[model samples]
Target: MADRSGNNKKKVNQGATLKKVFERLGKYRIFLIFSILLATVSVALTLYIPKLTGHAVDFIVSRGNVDFPGVLRVMVQIGICTLVTALAQWLMNVCNNKMTYQIVRDIRNEAFHKIEILPLKYIDGHAYGEVVSRVIADVDQFSDGLLMGFTQLFTGVATILGTFCFMLSVNVKITVVVVLITPLSFFVANFIAKRTFSMFKIQSETRGEQTGLIDEMIGNQKVVQVFGRGEDVTERFDEINERLNRASLRATFFSSITNPSTRFINSLVYTGVGITGAFAVVRGSLTVGQLSSFLSYANQYTKPFNEISGVVTEFQNAIACAQRVFELIEEEPQIPEPEQAVVLKDIDGNVKIEDVSFSYVPEQKLIEDFNLDVKPGQKIAIVGPTGCGKTTLINLLMRFYDVTGGQIKVENIDIREVTRKSLRAGYGMVLQDTWLKTGTIRENITMGRPDATEEEIIEAAKASHIHSYISRLPKGYDTWITEDGGGLSQGQKQLLCIARVMLCRPPMLILDEATSSIDTRTELKIQQAFAKLMEGRTTFIVAHRLSTIREADVILVMKDGKVIEQGNHESLLEQGGFYRHLYESQFAH
Candidate 1:
């Protein structure tokens, strides 16, 4: 009963996936209809050519008594059929190519759009390489399968039907022979397809795992080498690669069995038709030319069974791949903003976190009943040890993940009641992990405000103390960088990110260890720039280095997901509690 239930569920899922694929295809229904019509025309002409050949054969009744004119006229008809079939087949292929690629394009676009809106929790929980595989590798595999189905499956089925009709017109016995043996081919293909689907699905998953491992290792090669983990990484990779190899081999073995197995069955059908047709001719019930036509029809009728078997095998893999792509496209996105969500404008940045509770996992308590309130334009610094919810607080402020409990209000309005875009747009953030796209330095700086004037761009760069470095580059502001900001030091990358936020000068600022990478001298200069940037604007500075937040209006010390103490730097030092212990530990004599 359990096995039966599982099978039923699998069938339902497959049916739903097929429905999605067809719905995408239905958008190009006109092209699909045209392709089918052309396939029919092509197969009809192709099937007719065999009969014309048989007629040309019959016209040679005797060697010298042959009606040459009759044979020539039949040959002319055969030529016309061949030419028309080729033309129709060509046009059908063109239509199929256009429709198949368009559907793939739509699926890719939806998947990418879904990724963009996916909640931070979902992205954080999944490997980057696995998601990338769905978009790139799995989509490409589906494309190949769809193309094969369009190019071969349509015409193959049409030829089978046309040949059966043509054969029935010539002789009934041969048609019966071909029809009787065709099911064996289907039985073999169906049995293999059932097994191969699960195996191919396994193959795709393992391939994703392998891709994720490679991406993880390559992205952090420096860390891996520093930690002397090359051998361990290679061992892990080999294990995954072996699993992928095993799964691929099993799937290919089953799928490969389909084509030849069906061909063997088809060969038997052909032999049966030839043997039965010969006896009919001996019985004076059929002419040689008619028997010849029936034999050609028999071969044609069984040929599609072989071709369709291969198509089924490939289509199974495609379905598995499409399932992954669709899964990504259907992934739950970020919680939707309220229908009539307020759009924040000219924000005064008073913020209150009221009785907030949250956790990455539901069962584990991370932040519980957390609360804070700040006046507008207060430079509040958050200092904490690692994983004590400093970053989680930042995430909540950015609405990357919604709190599980309680409310966070900005300017006396619930943050959830405002559009996320508007809420996020009011703040400038520079994290320790700097990101720069592959573009000119000017482009990276002006990303938040693209219409910033050249003078403004230069000013921001100068303020962040990066203008001198940029001026030294060969192309200055126009110098192109790689995606990972290649050829740039960690300090330089951080400065570029700082310049980015400095240019925006948003109503609020979030600096999550923003100056952690730069030397102390550069840090002091950037801090001065940040001081100017923070003037009359609310700022939340998260830092492990206690020295930097000394000038902040308020300092909130946190530990174990709760604030332990809050005061100005001098008062917090006077308390001589956990806050003083942390400060003393860092700046101890």
Candidate 2:
């Protein structure tokens, strides 16, 4: 009754995501064709063996005499069939594996590439672990599971069809009894599968959340320890883990019951075939060999019912995982690059932001009607409170997010006119939080300009004031930088990032507290290095330290994403506006 209720609204074989999976497999249709052909030959040969065995029994029993030579001939035929069937089945498995791994490879490649082009908003909105699970864990499960499930599904149904055709030829009356009962297996499988689809989906999500929690805790373990929230973190992890466990258990339990229940129904059909066959024999409607053949065919015909039930139940989880993966791969990527983009070459560095308005969310306006202008090689400093859209301006300029209104032009050409890669390449950036992959110091520093000569790399390092420190390490420039720039001080990491920007020597610079990690003494050296790097380039500096931007050509004091004060240092001080107050607050003695 429970299984019957479960099937009422059942919609298994999730069409949208499943369609994509087969589309990928469609590329290997030749391999699919061979596998099917082999499966056909295998199932055909195996089913013929029962017929041969039944004939052998009749050859001896009807004559009431030993017919060793005749029976041996039948046995020899069965042996030949079994051997050829085994070979064909082995070839089918090989084809299935070849098809499965290639499809998985393409999926994983597309998924990884999808991450590269995905909008930053998607990355920011979801937990890092959840995304990782979709790309890595969920993809792996979908591949391995569907590999097994799909092959079983194809061959299982084929075997059932072949067996039914053969059994019908043997005795239609008993075959009808077997055919009548098989739908019960389908009903139970469909019901349980539909019931567990959402549960498995929940399990995938819970697993992702738990994975994300682990990543967040481990990635920021230092902060967690500093704040002494170890117990709190554990409590949160345990709660997520508990939910995952429940989801997994329910999904597995519900799906698992389908196989045994379906098998029990098949067994009852097996009993019915035997009872009916015995009556036919007593009434001289069937021979003893025919009764033997009928029962053997009954098992062969009904076995696939049990296998198909199991496949459907198990494939539900795979379907759920695949859908999650498809959800990510199908997300709208960063708006497409312009079709006929203008080349950004020999940029003169003039920039104009006219009436640019932007908002991350529609209801919450971050920047409204903002405007700015800077001449070639000028330094522009932007200072404001934390949530006042300081970083949002950078995001707009880099085209990470497009502006909702107005235009930003470089050299009098609107930035949208050029390709994103070329536009970004025009500017060098060093942010407050530095990023370093696991590689040597030289590799991380030269990431922006991979073709830099050794001498050029050394010069850039010297410019960032990190050359002397690199010389002291055992491997010098080759010393490895591990996860989170392991074994290096924050200042060292910042210097490496600065060196990266220095090597590129772009036409423009954007420094967001790029020197915050440096000590007072190193700060002086870095500021000097920065002066060289900034020479003859348009520079935008987001600084909290008023002294860092005192010499700027123009300083803009921003509030709530709008500039409230603008002028050179002394001029702004003379005006005594927000800039003056902000500077005074920090410098007051």
Candidate 3:
């Protein structure tokens, strides 16, 4: 059974969505008005041409007096009218294209900026390629459809209305028939449009999913090749690609049939009008000139009905894409900034977390009543089994997420009291999963501090033990890395990230499994440098390897989001609790 309620909701949204599209264009309403006026005049001129031709025919042949002057005069007027009509139509199209692109550009920019402000949770929940498709592919489709829709809209209306009024003045009886059949075009267009709108929406969504799959498979191509699971990946992609293909085909099939179906109905109306007017001419109720003009007006009247059906079909597709674009634009942004926020400044880096609680979802608490305190410069290690909220703790500290309960303070001020940018600026971070954009090595290192001198950059690199590797490269620091730092080993990428942190030289630091990718020898070589980096700064190290945190002044043993133990390595070993068991498991082997 058809979903009556669903259909009703869709109908309501359809009206609202198209209204939104025009509202965006309404920013340039003056241009739209000029385009409409030009289109109306163009259609009027074209409609009047047939009447002049019929007059010339009557003057030359029907009167049997070869009035060449009258015929030539009518011909000249028709010639001038057609030329002017064509020119006006050209200018109208130019305006339509301009308006279509300007609106699309604004919409694209809005969607992109929205992505930047959106919360990390929102981005994490959706696939990257899916978001990109809406920004790029969907926006492009909306623009193309609007260009066609706007170009045809005014001309279609003016042609239909002008032809009807002219035909009515000529013969009301035939004009009545034309009016009665116009509903056929509307009914057909509306029916197909309603049916196709849902299909187009599904198609847009499926295309995004398919794009996401390709992005995922290609991004992990190395893993796929090592496991030799290319066929499996391709099979999964094929399933999504096939679904997209079916949805697109259905949307296109339904919309494609509208124009021809409307045309068939329009042809029937034209035939009936021609036959009735012929009989009227023979009976002397209409003159031959007027009968000829009625035939042409019959065609003109039906043409817009046909064009309107096609434009409606295209506009329906555009509306589907526009709805998706608007959804992203309208989504609530991340946590709102405080109206009277303080900027974190010149910090000694004393940190305190008291009764802090957090949860990814409301029902299942991830971290509950967590607390920690650190002096201005202290080395702290966070160790736990996987999924024990170590990463979650770092995320909360960075303000990527906010604590659900309690407060985290930096230098006695609640972190929430300060601007996120300035609060984050107090810390430098290096993670296991390295991020290096497509740029030269020097550029990547200096990304955190763009104004650092070359010597300072090299010093940071040497501190990370990556300077020797850079010196050996073909272009040293000037060599370009591909997307995601392709062509570099994982260890090299991590070293570059460390170099980035060294240059940042923030008052606080977080190293989350930061050296996991580097070899033991290389890591040992940088141990002193790491110590130096930690000097005079509050630091947090999250590590699975117990060897790295032996010298930490305080070691936090986390289990299920709560700190289960806190002490120096020797004290934790003496306690023989969870932390001792974990440390022994690694070194005892």
- In candidate 1, what are the lDDT values of residues 203-315, reduced to their tens digit? 98999888889899988999999999999999999999999999999999989989899889989998998899899999999889998888888888888888888988898
Q: Which has the higher lDDT value, candidate number 1 or candidate number 3?
A: 1
**Winning candidate number (lDDT):** 1
Estimate every model's Cα lDDT from 0 to 1. Answer: 0.91, 0.88, 0.90
How far residue 55's Cα lies from its native spot in candidate 2, in Å, is 3.1
Give the root-mean-square deviation of each candidate in angstroms: 1.0, 2.8, 1.9
For residue 177, give model 2's deviation from the true position in Å: 1.6
Ranking by TM-score: 1, 3, 2
lDDT, candidate 3, 1-589, per-residue tens: 3799898888888888778887888899988998999998999999999899888878866455788999899989999999999999999988888888999999999999999999899899999989999999899889988888888878999998899888988899989988887788899998898888899899999988988888887788889999999999889989998998899899999999998999998898989888888899888899888888988998888888778888888877888888898899989998787899898888998999999999999999889999899998999899999999999999999989989999999999998888999988999999989998888999999987999999999999999989998999999999999767877899999999999999999999999999999999999976778889999999999999999999999999999999999999999999999999998889885
> Which whole-number lDDT from 0 to 100 does residue 140 have in model 2?
81
Model 2 agreement with the true structure over 496-563: per-residue lDDT tens digits: 99999989999999999999999989899888888887788999999999999988998888889888
What are the runs in model 2 whose C-alpha is more than 4 Å off?
A: 1-13, 59-64
Off by over 4 Å in 1: none
* lDDT winner, 2 or 3: 3
* TM-score per model over all chains: 0.99, 0.95, 0.96
Candidate 2 structure lDDT: 0.88
